[model samples]
Target: MATPPYPPPPPYVPQPPANRLGGKHKTVLGCGGLLFTFVLIGAIGSACSPTGSETTKKVPGPAVTVTVTATATVTPAANAAAGSPKRAQESAPAPAASAEPVTAKARLSNHVGQQLQAAQDAAQAEGFLVLTSHDATGGNRMQVWDRNWKVCSQSPGPGTLDTATTIDFGAVKLEEACP
Candidate 1:
């Protein structure tokens, strides 16, 4: 091999102290490390928290009582025999004890501008059954599996004392504007 004209350059060595990080860089690195540690701790704490599947026992509240009174009616034929006390007593039946009311009246809440499932849940929570009506005129077909419909209007507007056990909801697809 032919010898080179110039001698080979000295081996390069990095000066450690020349490129050392400054006070600002150290401060930034420390802050980033602390932030990362806090974030990691927060994530771990969230992971350890109870999820939906975990249930806690609830303490029950005091019981409520309702009183009702029942009245009995006597027919004319039975009353006619009232002249004979024994006969009248035998003919007339004993009055039954009053029972709790068949249905409870609840104030209905307006479900307008709410999602269908949320509306249904709210109604049902107040002891009312939900009856949903879908608007298909907008070219969208309603399906049982789809719950993304929004309620446009509700029957028995908000704060109405509802005697009926069922409440009606008029709903349309989420993409459609309310009527």
Candidate 2:
């Protein structure tokens, strides 16, 4: 028996080009790289953002005009008689005297005593109607209450003020309680 005349050459298998990349693999890799870049940029922006001591620009406000107009009006007697403001119908009357403001002076006994009369007088003098007067033991002075009170001046010196008008003189605690 003799060998075949032509020995078959090794099978011719074709190889793909080296530089070619898969379409799906390239798309996925590019997209992943783009997403990573975007995420990195976003993180950097957030970190540098004005998280502390942030400031805002103030927008200019619209211009405004203040136009003042008198609201007073004059009416006839007939209208006033029909239950209008009496001031409109009556002849202009003389200006009434201005009442003086109320004032008061008081002395606390031994820093704690109920000598409220002095306070009352001072309040009357200053044109204030005394409502209630009491000893402010916690405040170490006398406190007088009224509709409106103010201490024009104290007799001795700088004293504690309870209200705009009411004040406390120097406190002197008595050895014995007042009768």
Candidate 3:
């Protein structure tokens, strides 16, 4: 048997110091580069701050001006009464009168037609206004009165004296037909 020959080894080439950065040196250089970048950014920011010139100053915002004026012409005291009506004077508001119903000496019980008259008389005596009177039901008439003897509202409600008390003297009327 013949012996086979072995192949020769390939030639070897030496590598140069391919790495430019060493471990600690690389860390220091990276830190220095970062510091330089930060300083450059800070310088740019300082340059961009307002310089009080038209281009560096902020644009003027919308200018606004507001003015208000009021004028009043005073009327004389005597002339003020000319526009108001006579009735308005009569109806001049009074202090809220005692809400407690006024007591009547005459009992309104069994008094239908006479209810209005009784209310009117009671109101007159009490110094209230008697506006008008009309029949509300059989034996019942309502009378209306203002704070003064001025009639305001009336109806013929023939219930009783107690019932009429609540009617505020305004529902008593002196009419023949019941409303």
TM-score each candidate.
0.46, 0.21, 0.24
Candidate 2 wrong stretches, greater than 4 Å: 1-17, 54-179
lDDT of 2 by residue, 16-44 (tens): 86967789889999999999999999999
Query: Would you give me the overall lDDT of model 3?
Result: 0.42
TM-score of 3: 0.24
How many clashes in each candidate?
A: 0, 17, 21
- Please list the C-alpha lDDT of all candidates, in the order they appear: 0.64, 0.42, 0.42
Alpha-carbon RMSD, each predicted model: 14.6, 25.1, 36.1
Compute the lDDT of residue 12 as modeled in candidate 3. Answer: 97
- Which stretches of candidate 1 lie above 4 Å from their native place? 1-67, 73-92, 96-102, 136-140, 163-165
Top of the candidates by lDDT: 1
Please give the distance, in angstroms, between residue 163's alpha carbon in candidate 3 and its true position after superposition: 80
Q: For model 2, what is the alpha-carbon lDDT of residue 3? A: 94
Question: Which candidate's TM-score is highest?
Answer: 1
For residues 1-179, what per-residue lDDT tens digits would candidate 1 score against the true structure? 99999999999998766858899999999999999999999999878753433222322322223345676655544555558776766776666555656544566666677767777766666556646566634545664633557778777687645445456677887767876
Model 1 / residue 135 / CA error / Å:
1.4
